[model samples]
Target: MKVFLAIAAKVRGTGVERAMAVARRSIGAAFPVPAEEVTHEEWREPGAALLAWTNEPGPAITYAAGVSGYLADPRDLPAAAAGDLGLGGCYSLFTCRSAATGPTGADPVYHAETPELHVYGSRALLVHLVATGGRVEHDPLALQSMVRQGYFLSDETPFAGVRALPPGHRITAGRAEPYGLAEPTDLASALVASVRGIEGTARLTLTGGRDSRLIAATLHAAGIPFTAVTYGTQDNPDVILARKVARRLRVDHQVIAPKPVTPDDTATRVAEVLRTCEGMTSAYENVAPHTPFRARPSLGGHGGEILRGGFLLGCQDHRRKLDALFLGNLDLLTAEAAEHARGLAESWQPTPETLDHLYLRYRVGRWHAAARAGIQRSGLRIQPFLDHRVVTAALAVDPAERATQGLVHGLIAELAPALARVPFEARRWPWSKPAQKTPDWRSEPGDALKSAILGSRELAAIVRLDRVEPLLYGPRLPKPALVWHLATVATLLRPMRMAVAA
Candidate 1:
């Protein structure tokens, strides 16, 4: 088992160095491996300094700890607790100068120095840890004590086969269950149960989306004390609708504005965020390019996709019509590619095989696998949507009820009029406007040239190809491939020479 940790903090003169030293000492005491430190030069692009350690030929457990002056939302505490408690075998700690600046591209970035740590070995382990915010403690007596108090147990990672949580633990809503099986009333009751099970503060994510709104409504109906948070540009529909819903519920609401990402900064920042996420299910998962971590246990509404069915149901319907139309009209070349694509498409049909594959192959299965590896490496348990019962219910719902047009969850809103009243409107913000209007740089010749100069060969090697081939020359690439291409282009355009130097 190998363990790695990255810490970020602002430099407070000599005190920052002392803090780093102390953090290293604490980590070393908890793990058997020797730690290594890598300090960033002042002018470096990703300026965050890092300390990493790996354990080999030993137990698969890895521990990581990050300390920042920035205060996180109390709701995120469970995740923090889980990450910290899980420290054993191998450990890494990251100490930043200050939390005021948060984690910006130029402000001594961390994680870019290492990327492979983000891969999780198991999805179930990752989901369980993130959802509960609990880790397997080293002390059996202590673990037993926490369990007696109602903490949950978690063991969804690859390295360590088993993990335990203290009593009163709760999983995030989206990851709780499949979309359709649970009735609105049942979901609401589950939310209430999760809240009641926890001691002290709880945070609820409120968005214009029905799932979040429903959760908030349920919390209110249950008289649970919670802080509601919404993030986006001010004009985003979610921001607008969330505000309205918060007002109606008369709960405290906090709105986070989206940050701006220039062509020069996007790739590095995305990579860093991904590294921090380490245990996420999707390679595309990020904490919004601009927004820094503000609070913990950030309630994510990712389960909405399952609740409404996968995002591609409508496209599937459209393809079915197109297939009928083009039965004999399409050329052989197009037909061959379409044949393969069609099989992939048809695999998503609402059937036992499709449902099982969706859950095991993509949804929980893959997600948990990625998450397990990431959590071990980064020590950050990212619980996006880990409500199991809710997800199971969603899976049981008929496919017709899970509309591609966002009508399925919408129908649920109709069933619960009060839920429909919760506001969920998308709004655009001033800062985001410029980027939205800016032409994609990958289409520009200058960007392409820059890419060729800044180690295109290396990029090619990472991609396992002798040359950068045009997509038009081969079979159509998958969506993930397209995103990686864009990301590679972004990386080339933004040379980290200056950022790394600082």
Candidate 2:
């Protein structure tokens, strides 16, 4: 896995060193592969530096295409070339969009803003807190949001005094402007161009969904050879239809099976998934064993559905609908958390017509960002649908056309007619054998579920233990989904708690 931890400080000293050390240890311990520090350098600002480690060829950071120009070092960052930092091929995966450090707060703060997908900015929150010697504490509103929706809305995170940069916001200006991608004709053209821009062949995560199918069709039309990878059992419609789609295109297809785990490894695996997801998603939904992709650029269809109005289907009244959906479960919230929960809709700036665009920034930007980060641990990952040009074009299409998936259907027909021949798998057939599902901890023969929740003092403090404890032995059990959400949030907080305690 290729990863980096960079700090920008007012002056180079012991604090910066301590911050970097903590970040490296925190990141290294959570992932499957150990992150060895391979490249470290100090920049012009007395203490500013970028430290990187990788098993891959390039650094995770790259020069971003921004107001400056394509590939131009806008800020003239250090010209030093190390193992992967400056060797530059197309380092688009985690490109640095903008960076700035302080007018001094208690001490200097290090800010590195990258236009990367899936992570939003939680990965860098640790550095921000540690560099300033800031205390770490659970943010109640963030906890409430996580409990209700599995992830935060707007820029909320699970930590107080620390917030993720809002989606598509420029760090220096604090603006949420639409990301522009030069200009490509339509969705297909924009996707093809983006994929072509990657340094190597892209690995497509093919599924039965319309989003991935559109990507597959576009790649086939462009004559780009890409491997289609599916994750699920043979009985899974996604696996079945993905195979059909791959065969029609005559491209290589690979399926990764879902394996059931023993009770002994359940806790360990759950913690790893928690670290990967940043605790924004449930580990129960993703308990399958995952093998990292062979070091290659991976392409995902994230944010595509939003383009076709999949996220904004039924609600004409955006304000009323969004509030009803996100704002609830306030009984357990602290006063501050309750206030923050009430403010979510305002932060999103939702309106009836622009709801689709808002969902992109709200859901895709925040929740999808975490999922994308988890996948990147496998290798470099990119989402073509979120490409600025495609998003711009998709948003421009008539609402009626998008609602009926007119844009997506037409593009698939144009790109690869053969693909359109195979019907999209919206739902499995009534008689189709059920795909293998990951067993819940209760099903595992042991005290896995009880140990996980009861053992976490941090979790007990946030969630009422009395409510969760009795359900563990249940004649009636706690919802598996809720338990997963609780466990994940607790796992994320554990390391930070230990750091705070130390």
Q: How accurate locally, in lDDT, is each candidate?
A: 0.34, 0.53
Highest lDDT: which candidate? 2
For model 1, state the Cα shift of residue 303 in Å.
2.1
Which candidate gets the maximum TM-score versus the true structure?
A: 2
| lDDT at position 230, candidate 1 | 85
Give the per-residue lDDT of model 2 (tens digit) for 1-502.
4443345443334244565555554544333344442432222224434444444444334432111011112233333121112211112122222322111000011233222211112254444344334445565546666765676665555555445544333343223232332333566676666555555577899999888999888777767778999988777888989999999999899999966654546577666666565455566555333454445667757667755785566556766667754675554444565676777656555554556655665566556655555555455555566554466556667654686776788888888999877878647778977645565553332366677666777665556666655556655355555555656666666645424322
Q: Which stretches of candidate 2 lie over 4 Å from their true place?
A: 1-33, 37-42, 59-97, 100-122, 173-185, 198-203, 231-236, 254-266, 285-293, 314-321, 331-336, 346-354, 398-401, 430-478, 491-502
lDDT of 1: 0.34
